[model samples]
Target chain A: MKRNSRLSLALHTLSHMADDPDRVRTSADIADHAGTNPVVVRRVLGRLREAGLLTSEKGHSGGWKLARKPERITLADVYLALDESLVATANEDSDPVCSVEYALHRRVSGVLREIEQSLVKRLGETTISEIR
Target chain B: MKRNSRLSLALHTLSHMADDPDRVRTSADIADHAGTNPVVVRRVLGRLREAGLLTSEKGHSGGWKLARKPERITLADVYLALDESLVATANEDSDPVCSVEYALHRRVSGVLREIEQSLVKRLGETTISEIR
Candidate 1:
């Protein structure tokens, strides 16, 4: 198993946006620079926009721009925007027939929650400006 | 996505073993304590056995026992024993049609590697005895 690539992509994009907060960069251009598909860039940007970290416009000369200052944003904000979970799992049945499975899940979930909170806390301490 | 329950199982089971050190535990018994399926515990044990963190026997009265002292083992050892990756991913094709996807994968992979290393470092600092 591997972590999602969206995490870094979101951070990288945010750094770019933060570098030039006043300029609006289209997804196409961002994708080109980032060496990815424009569609993928747009999808990521959409999530950031929804997170209120960025805003966008629809027109020939319109694209995406940061909604807030670079210092105000963190990696956690981007991760939340992408709706990425801190842990990974397969289809675990709602009713795990085995009690051991139940206990195992609970304990693991606790650790995962702790890890995630730690991750968020670390990310929270760093701003987009730092990455850029 | 959530992290693998096996990670916790490995750690928790190791902690228990460390506490007793002399008592051999059956999968069923361990599962009961941890609230999971015996099969799951056995499978996790199998991995631990392979990793040299544990060993098992297969007889009427046989079960599993730690291969090493609690002070000699860490959570990273358990995680490695379970072959669990620090990151999570869905089927990412070897050939990403999009360059951004490729770049994203590389960057994410880098960060994941760093995080995994960090986790291992932290886990290495603590032993099963500590957890117990």
Candidate 2:
């Protein structure tokens, strides 16, 4: 399966915003810096706004800006904003009759849950300011 | 991007093999149980064999079997056998001139590396025997 880079892209865009909080960054400009299309930039940043990490303005001089200081936003915050699981598991519901599959799924799921928790905790320890 | 489930699939397949070590399972049989195609099963199991976790034999009775006891095989071993990164990074080299991009890439890479190492360590703590 392909790996998602939304987190990376969001962080990249946020860091650019943090570089100059007063300067509004248009989707086209951010996309140019991010080596992606404006639609993708807008899509990712839109999630960031919904997460309360960013704000978008409309009309003349309209663009995206961080809602709070970089120090106030942690990597964990960004991660949660992206709304994706940190790990993947097999589709357990896909094969209900197989006891072997059930047992395997249970164990793997438990371990993955632990790993994701650990990752989120570690991420919470780091703020966007620390990275920027 | 879609999350890859190869690790979960490998663990599931290994647990099944561990349940009856004396029984040799064919690719088709494993595929049926794995809710995947035979080719997918063979491809994944082929990596497990190359990692010395299983053995494949040829002949009318030929199939696949664990090369060692389940207790000796850790989830980390299975993960390494699959040879996939636990985390994804943006294509950093895609934009070389942007310093903001560079800073974001460096920090993100460091965090992901730490997360991967932590994940591998946790996986190493559990073995196929425990899961089975």
TM-score of chain A for the candidates in order shown: 0.87, 0.88
Proportion of native contacts in model 1? 0.18
Error of 1 at B88 (Å): 8.7
Write model 1 residue lDDT over B18-113, tens digit each, in one string: 778879889999887766789988888898898898889899989999887888987668767776665434444556647754665555455545
Model 1 / residue A113 / CA error / Å:
3.0
Residue pairs of candidate 2 with colliding backbone atoms: none
Against the true two-chain complex, what DockQ does each candidate achieve? 0.24, 0.42
Q: At residue B105, what lDDT does model 2 achieve?
A: 68
What stretches of model 2 exceed 4 Å from their correct place? A1-3, A90-92, B1-3
Kindly report which residue stretches of model 1 are placed more than 4 angstroms away from their true locations once superposed.
A1-3, A31-40, A87-109, B1-3, B31-40, B87-112, B129-132
Give the lDDT of residue A73 in candidate 1: 90
